[model samples]
Target: MKTLLLLEWMKVRKYKTFWAFIILFAISLAGINYFIHNVQIQTKSLTHGMADIQIFSFPQIWSTTAWAGGFSVLLLGILIITLVTNEYSFKTHRQQIIDGISRKQFISGKWLTIIVFIIFAWISYFILTLIVGNHTENISVFSGFDYAGYFLVKMAVSLSVAFMFALLFRRSGLAIALYLVYVFILEGIVKHFLDKIAGGLGMFLPLSAGGYLVSNPMRQAIPGIETIHIQPVWILLTCLGYLILFVYLSYRYINHADL
Candidate 1:
């Protein structure tokens, strides 16, 4: 596994695009959370404490940061897609196979790369939560930390979805275009109609299920706001199911398809 990951690292070590996306993802995560923190402070000052919600305080910070961090996860998804499609574009995947690595190892190496990206994201979120929370309020560091776990699962499902799309299309442009459309447009549209047809079943969609794990932290601050109530266990299971399915499909495709 270390060998496989090292090989994957060598491919992207000097790739400017990879670093660009990584930096972008990091900036987006920090920037968005900073913006929200400022907004929360401004609201407190304007409302004179009536509307002040302690979103940045301990437990809430975990969910708030996780929810806000979801937007940045899209950039990581793009990174994964680009990395996988680059393998096809440069014919490096075939080269690795010719070098006597089995198909499973190639795919395993890619999955390992995805795992690394996911860990990076998780650690980033954890550090951001601690910094933001401590600056806002000193509370139990581990309180509501399970949201960090949910964020990790969300990253796994999202990046795996990107990986599957990249393997299926083998073209970065098309895969990324379709990925954006699905995440930003199609899923919401389909989920809306599905909800209209059958209440909350729309959350079962792969990305939707992942998203269901975390919700808007400010939902409680608004008066008379209604939010869907789904058990966390179901959502977690749904995300894990999709994660497994996506990995299986990607492996199957690359295992049998022509390079």
Candidate 2:
């Protein structure tokens, strides 16, 4: 298993796309921080009036990291999809199979890469949060752990779902674009409609539930639909279901495919 992991790590290290993604993620976070900094300057306060506006702040900079990384989940998903298809793109997976690496090892290696990247992405959020400003005294024992855990779980599910889409489509860009549509567009509409019909029940869905977990608490006290008040247990179950299903399908697909 260690040998397999080492070989996979080497492949990831050598892949230009992986490095390109890291660079992109960094640039994006920096760009968002810059924009948020400007907005903070303009407002100069967390709220405007009874309007209860959701204000951006330096202390909340981690949310920018979360947004950037969360938005990039589709890209990561596409990357995962492409990793497999790229074998066909480069005629490598077939050769690896011929060289005695089982399909199981190949699939496991890809999953390990995804999990490693997921951790890196979350850590990127944490480091940026520290850079932004102060941690509020309101942070409780459970609040801090729960907030962090929620962020990590949402990221994991997003990446896993992206992998599943890639497995289904086998084309990186198309699969990723589809994933983006689901996240940014389709889910938005669904949540809006659900909010009208069921109110807080929308929190049960992945995006809505995740919105509840990571949303700035102060922002939630204000008016407008409260997508951020989701229960931790529901988000946990939804994310876990996604992770398991994606991993299972990844194995089943690769094991049975014509490859």
Candidate 3:
């Protein structure tokens, strides 16, 4: 276990590009927060009515964190995908195998690092929320707590997704590019089609359904979309299913994959 951790740490330390992503993550979050703050300032009067009333009686932190961590997940996904893909792209995996690092340990160590970073990002995001808004207005301690939980679970799910993508593509650039395309383009288009075909069932599309567990209460309250208000229980189940399915698939693939 110690050796696996050490190896993962070494991978992180030796990679400058991977480190560069931290700056990008910070910048993206800052930009989003700045935009949201400005909009809030302009519309403060309109939104003041909803401040005290808690819309989400059965609030799931996972949903809140997923909303806040949306951008973080995008950034982290790219980083993780790249990190895993680069190992294969650079032939580092073969060397690690040669050094007697079992595939299971390698996968476990990477996942451990991912979990640590996910927690760090979640805390950082919650802190940023507090920093960007007044403590009494536009913010609540419960909201922060809820979002933190969401971010942690979202990170776990995203890590599993990244692991699968990395193992499949085995090329950092390809994995990252594909992920970006899927997020920015494919998901939007696919979701629309699915929504039409399956009617209400389409709201349960993998990413969209997982999204329900972590979305902001306000955003989740938009009218006319009946299925959008997926119950917290359903959201939890969907997320769990995705996590288990992807982890099992990635594990099987990585275990049998030729370095």
lDDT of each: 0.88, 0.67, 0.67
Model 1 residue 20 lDDT score? 94
Q: Clash pairs of candidate 1? A: none
Estimate, for each residue in 141-177, the C-alpha lDDT of model 3 and write its tens digit.
4654655665566667766676677778887878888
lDDT per residue as tens, model 1, 108-182: 998999999999999899888888785434567898988999989888888898888898788999999999999
Model 1 CA deviation exceeding 4 Å by range = 45-48, 135-138
Candidate 2 lDDT, 1-259, residue by residue in tens: 7887798777778889977877877777667656755655555454554433233333344454465456555556667766756766677778888999999888887778788878887777667656664455664322334455677887777777666776677666777678778878888888778978987666666665666556643454445753444556777887677677778888998899977
The Cα error of candidate 1 at residue 82, in Å, is 0.6
Q: Using Cα atoms with residue i matched to residue i, what is each candidate's TM-score against the true structure?
A: 0.94, 0.79, 0.83
Best by lDDT: 1
lDDT: which is higher, 1 or 2?
1
Question: Which 10 consecutive positions of candidate 1 have the poorest summed lDDT?
Answer: 132-141
Deviation in angstroms for 176 in model 1? 1.0
Winning candidate number (TM-score): 1
Model 3 residue 96 CA deviation in Å: 0.9
